[model samples]
Target chain A: MLTKRIIPCLDIKDGRTVKGVNFADLRDAGDPIELGARYASQGADELVYLDITATQQDRRTFSALVREIARHLDIPFTVGGGISSINDVAPLLEAGADKVSINSAAVRNPQLIDELAREFGSQMVVLAIDARKSGNQWQVFTNGGTQPTEKKLFSWAKEGQERGAGEILFTSMDHDGMKQGFAIDPIQKLSRLLNIPVIASGGAGRQEDFLSVFKLGEADAALAAGIFHFGQLSLPTLKQYLSKNGVIVR
Target chain B: MKTVIIKYQGGNVQSVAFALERLGASATVTDDADTIRTADRVIFPGVGEAGSTMKYLRERKLDQLIPSLEQPVLGICLGMQLMCRFSEENNTRCMGIFDVDVVKFPAKPLKVPHMGWNSLHNTKDWIGDSLDGKFAYFVHSFFAPLNPCTVAEVTYGRPFSAALRTNNFFAVQFHPEKSGDSGMRILKAFLDQSA
Candidate 1:
């Protein structure tokens, strides 16, 4: 049986990790490379570096930071944000990133997914969906969850899978940074509907939340930010707890 | 001494070469057989369809030359699969250096590509202290089953050969070059063996 993965997401801006309170009030945490190594040593199954800054200056810094992290870390890392072309993914992957996650570019041109999947196998391409609840349904958001789209969560996810996304990283805006728990109902439905692995992100406050996503939500992986960056919950301790609760974690 | 990484229209050789440079070894990327045969060690790393890759190798006469080498040869991922007798991927015939067949994991709830780090158990003595019971990085849908040639084993849906060795020919289903410290140790060990 495949073990569930625990990931720590680091939002990179100007080559430094910037931690925010509910995606606002950003503060510099540390160097992206150092933070990545710390998380990997702490037993993070994977690391996600989202380039939060959209400027040209920030992009170069982010690329440099990605090269630094890729040189040091051994685990799989996913780099995202501001990636608009197939050419954009090449340098990041060549720099040592195992996978590249596309958000705004992918939603705009779904054909990019097929082109990327064809050039660099589906396993190397990840589709990140930033979703927020709209009345009874979840709506996909673009541009780091600022702009909204009419595409429903389930339909967009299905489209992404059909377009050859190897995995889906679903982040719920409502539960993000709240520390309440994961939005399990919608995630579980998506997981059941999609054959590819689904990584549940947002609202992971405690060890039980991780277990809940794995057991109840049936997510292939769980990704948290605030808890890990602030040193509130460590990965090894969490993995030990999950193992005790009959969750197979490696 | 510089290492020659054989690049024959395959996968992940540039990354593997970059990894070699990080380990203080100068690496040259080329498909020229002379360049590969003259290097201190040759790394054949690839990621793609097995049948197409073997076809490419045969077209270049690399299929006939790889097994006849006297120097240390390391194959990673699909490169390792191509070293076996046959593969279930595209019903491809492979190099007969190791008498094993690569088969896909049976249909299950588990993902087709067994991606991520898995422990390699039941290691052979030749593996030395460099690689024994240590986890290595693997990403592949098809695997080579265990036999007398198996040097290490890892379990997914079932136990499979993670590493196989037969004289100068060494192949690992996992990517040692990308597997961090444990993987680096394996590369160092291979270097030591060749030296």
Candidate 2:
């Protein structure tokens, strides 16, 4: 059986790992290479590095960090953040990232998704959508959730799958950093609506949240940053918790 | 022992090389027929479209050179698909080294690119049955159904060939290079065949 994936997201800024609550109030997590190696040792199914670095100069550092992280990790990992074009993706993959995630830039130029999927098979491309529920509908947000777009969550995700995204990583902005639980309703709806794998992000406070997301939300994988980063939950223990609760994890 | 990784557009060569390095063996990433043919073991790693990758292989005549060689050759992911008779992906014909057809996973409400870690069963040969029931990372949409050559099996939607072997050629649908320690042991086993 294909076990549900447990991912620890490392938010990288200026070459250091940090986690924010609701995408603000950043805190030092540790060195990415060390943290990544730690998670890999503890049984993280996959790792994702969101390069929240703002300037282009720091971009080189992020690639270097990715290379170092790749050297240390045997498990697969995805790299993203500010990746808008095929050019930006080539370097990260060259540096040994297994996959690349595209967010705001993809929304800005939706054609980028098609180009990436065509050039490098859809399996190598992941489309991340950050959205918030407004008036009973999830609205797509961009620029680190500070700006809103015309795309609705479900429709845009369906379009992404049609456009050749290998997987859909849906992060709920409203539920992000809440530590309450995952946004199960929309996640379940998205899982049913798409043929591709859905990775649920945001709102993981306890180990039970991981189980609920996989069991209730039907998420193929659940990703969290703060809970894992702050030691609020360790991946091995969480996997044990899920396994005992009838959720298969790896 | 010398190892050569076939240099092609699709193969995720760097990680494979890194894994070999982890095992204390170094590999050369190359497209030259001589370099690949002369090596003790050749690795055909791939992760690109079938039609285009086949075209690249044919244009460079790797399609012919691959099957003619006698040394142990390992194919990963798309590399494994291309070693088959044909693929549903882009309707492209493959190298025919393995007597199997690569078909896309059925649209049965299950995910297409069945991503994440999955366990392997009924393992033998270079894959090592000791590693049976061990988890390996997988990310693919197309798979080869069970056949006489299958040495290992993994079920996702249905039982499929996770690993196949015949004489000097071996292939695996999963990315063993990125599948943690369990995968490392598989690579080590493949390398051990160099004896």
Candidate 3:
């Protein structure tokens, strides 16, 4: 049986992890390689490194970091943030990132999804959508969730799947950084709508939040940044909590 | 022992190389036929559509060159699918090293990609000894069905060959390079195979 995935996201800035990672053995929180290795050892199903700024010069540093991270990790890792074209995706994949995720760029140009899926199989492409609840509907946001788009959440997810996105990562702008819990309504809706796996992002405060997202949200995977970076919760404990709660976690 | 990773367009080669590096073996990634044929162990790793990948291999004549080799050749993911007789993916024919067909996973209740880790069972003395009841990471839509050559098996919606071995040729539908310690041990066992 396929198990639920537990992912720890690392926000990278200037080639360093943004948050101070508090893994027990590692002293350097800025060292993404160390944090990633720690997460893997602690039974993280996968890892995601988001380049916060993704400047022209930072791409080089991010690429280098990806190479070092890949060399150290045996599990799959994904690279996202500012990946707009095949040119941006190639270096990261060449650097050993198992998958490359697209966000604002994919919304700006939906054909980019097709091009990426064609060049490197769909499994290598991840479509991340940032959204917020508006009235009775959810609105898709872009440009680091600062710009609101006319596209709705469910339709865009369907379109992404039609264009061959391997997985859909839904990040709730309202729920992001809230420490309350995930946007259960949106996650459950998307999980029912998309045929591919849906990864619920944002709003994980407690261990029960993980269980809630898995059991209630029906998410194939859950990604958290602060909870993991600040050592609010470790992956092993989280997996154990989920396992004991009737959720099949790896 | 020297290891050569057969590199072609649309394949994830770095993780495989890193996996070997973790086991104290540095691998050389190459597409040259001569380098591949002469290597102690050859690894054919890929992550792409079967038809296009086969075209790339045929353009470089790797199709004919791959099957004629005498060394222990390991095919992974699309590599294993391409090693079979045919693939329903884009309606392409493949190398007939393993007489099996790669078919798409059924839609609806069971997901297509069959992504994530799955346990392997049913043992073959040489390759399956250490891997019995061990989990390995897999990410693929099409799978090779159970056959005479199947050594390790796993089930998603139905039973499928997780690992297949026949003399000098060996292949796995899972990504040993990305499957943590168990995967590394499998790769080590493959490398430990006497040539």
- Give the chain A TM-score for each candidate: 0.97, 0.98, 0.95
Interface RMS deviation of candidate 1: 2.5
Q: lDDT tens digits, residues B1-195, model 1?
A: 657778865377656765776678878888888887787788888876787789888998999889888888888888889999999988999998889999988747676578777877887745664465576777788999889899888899788888888888888888887676777777777666852
lDDT of 1 by residue, A44-86 (tens): 8788999988576677777777777766776778999899888
Estimate, for each residue in A1-250, the C-alpha lDDT of model 3 and write its tens digit.
Answer: 6888988888887777774222112222467889889998898888999887798998998899999999999999999999889999999999899999999999999999999999998898899999988998899998888789999999999999999999999999888877899999889989998888899998889999999998999999999988888888988888888989999866
DockQ, candidate 1, vs. native dimer: 0.40
The C-alpha interface RMSD of every prediction is 2.5, 0.9, 0.9
- The model with the greatest TM-score is 2
TM-score of 3: 0.96
The segments of candidate 3 whose C-alpha lies over 4 angstroms from its true place after superposition are A19-29
lDDT string for model 2 (B1-195, tens) is 789999887568889988898889999999998988899998999888899999999999999999998988999999999999999999999999999999998877688988889999999878887988899999898999999999999999889999999899999999989999998988888888853
lDDT of 2: 0.91
Between prediction 2 and prediction 3, the one with superior lDDT is 2
Cα distance off (Å), candidate 3, residue B21: 1.2
Model 1: residues >4 Å from true position, as ranges?
A56-58, B8-10, B21-24, B55-60, B128-133
